[model samples]
Target: MAYQTFRQEYLQVPPVTRAYTTACVLTTAAVQLELITPFQLYFNPELIFKHFQIWRLITNYLFFGPVGFNFLFNMIFLYRYCRMLEEGSFRGRTADFVFMFLFGGLLMTLFGLFVNLVFLGQAFTIMLVYVWSRRNPYVRMNFFGLLIFQAPFLPWVLMGFSLLLGNSIIVDLLGIAVGHIYFFLEDVFPNQPGGGRLLRTPSVLKAIFDTPEDDPNYNPLPEERPGGFAWGEGQRLGG
Candidate 1:
């Protein structure tokens, strides 16, 4: 009965979010089971180019260290923001969402070459949080009930929190950089005078994943950005 309930809820998650979160979980579980080592999953440009271990490009973003508080925290934020983005901004636009994934992954992969990050799953999560916060700037949010700020500041707050834990800041910075690039190109630039969309979703992707023909007249649903108010030291960051 418990398994059935879990499966039902899991099946209800949006496709992109479901796939990503599931991949992260399975990768972590595999590591825990000793079926795969982080050494085999982490990013290595040399291995990718020389030996053609192309899977590393993706597996790098699928492991988030051994299961612990950090893993739960990242998974919570990742699932929440990623789902909100898909069901909110990218509603009925699966292909475009996938394209954004491709674009962000590509940019991160290129930048990862110069950085010392092994598993970029946390960074990728930050990127999702950054984009979601930017799109819903008016939303009120609080961090662990100690800090109250607007939505746009959530990413920075997370970075600050990570700093407190003594983790390297490079990962956070990389996420913010890539997220800002995506936000500027997709949301900011197109709205500017005489500026057109620089990141067009490829037709092939559309044909493969989704199509305009799916709906002759499609209206976007409301943004699923979280909104609320609370007092006390809540571990989660939400508004």
Candidate 2:
């Protein structure tokens, strides 16, 4: 699904989501034009590097390479996970989700850079926001065209494969750490109930928001009328 559609249906989107998505598009375009130096923002260097751009904190979220199966697969997972979170949160509270996502991404990148400078000469952080969001280990997703399985094992599986192939384990570990922190913080401060009994429903929202019995969902309904209180202001009462 397009970002616009998600925004409309969800009724709110955190500013960071827009920033991250924009960064991804720009970074991909630059890569297509043979711009490699700009992509270096994803890494950390010894001492103070001139190429060190502060904007990379946000751009890092968007620098996921070009259009391929990898990108498509990642996007699909992102959409599914993001949408699930959005739907569970109170109506009109997209900012909270965005904050958590960007904050996690930024920390993961920073940790990756530090590890690279200290141990390995190069490191690449994997986005672990989706994995962290899967608080329930039982949550599952369809793999390829056949398999349907849980995600908790997927991260470990990927990490194992990467290690076997001599990939950057440092970056992967840092990403997991960052993801854990994000999950922890989110559990502490959550969105408030919009206004309904739906908030009382036994779901993630109830657990996060700690909504009271009086709190109403306030979610817009189809039959609800909009605008001024009186439908017919000037109509004659006894004609």
Candidate 3:
């Protein structure tokens, strides 16, 4: 019964978030068990090009350092925010969500070439947090019971916390940067006087991931709820 209950709860997580968090956990477990070396998963242009090791591009974002506090911290944020976004704004829009992932990943990869950073999972988490916060700006937030603020400040608060932890803020900044670009293009710019949608999901991707209207499981909600409150329910400790 206990196993079944656990399984049920696990199955409740959104599909993309579930798959992503599972990959991160399993990747870390593989490294911790000595089944794989960390060197193999890091981003390397030479390995990707000369050696044709394309897996590194994707794997780099799957493994955060070996199972430790930082790993746990990042995983929590990644899973929480990613799931919230998936079930919230991006709900019923699987293809759009996937497009966001592709868009962010592609931008991050391009920027990674100029920066010395590898393993972009942290940055990716920030991007998720950024999008969630922006879409739910009126939602109140409390950080570690010490500070209170609105949703949009979440990313900067996280960057500050990262600075305090002595971890580089560059990754967090990068996530925020890319996230803003996506948000502006997708959400902001499109609403301008003459602006039009810049991020249209490909028809093939939509057909593959989106549910048909006739499907019983298909349900759609307004982009923003009528009330000032956001439908998401979760607690954020810090960052």
Return whichever of 1 and 2 wins on TM-score: 1
Q: Per-residue lDDT tens digits of candidate 3, residues 1-239?
A: 99999997787776788889999999999999999998999999999999999999899999989778788788877877787788788877888999999999999999999999988999999999899889988766667767777778889998999999999999999999999999999999989999999899999989898886433553323323312222223233332
- lDDT over C-alpha atoms for residue 187 of model 2: 47
Clashing residue pairs for model 1: 227-239, 228-239
Where in model 1 is the C-alpha error above 4 Å? 211-239
Q: Lowest-lDDT window of 10 residues in candidate 2?
A: 224-233
TM, every model: 0.89, 0.54, 0.89
**TM-score of candidate 1 on Cα atoms, chains taken together:** 0.89
Candidate 3 ranges with C-alpha deviation above 4 Å: 213-239
Kindly list the per-residue Cα lDDT of model 1 for residues 129-222, writing each as its tens digit: 8998888777667565678777788889889889999988889999999999999999999999999899999999888888555444433323
The C-alpha RMSD of each candidate to the native structure, in angstroms, is: 4.0, 14.8, 4.7
lDDT of 3 at 42: 96
Query: Whole-model Cα lDDT per candidate?
Result: 0.83, 0.44, 0.83
Clashes in predicted model 1: 2
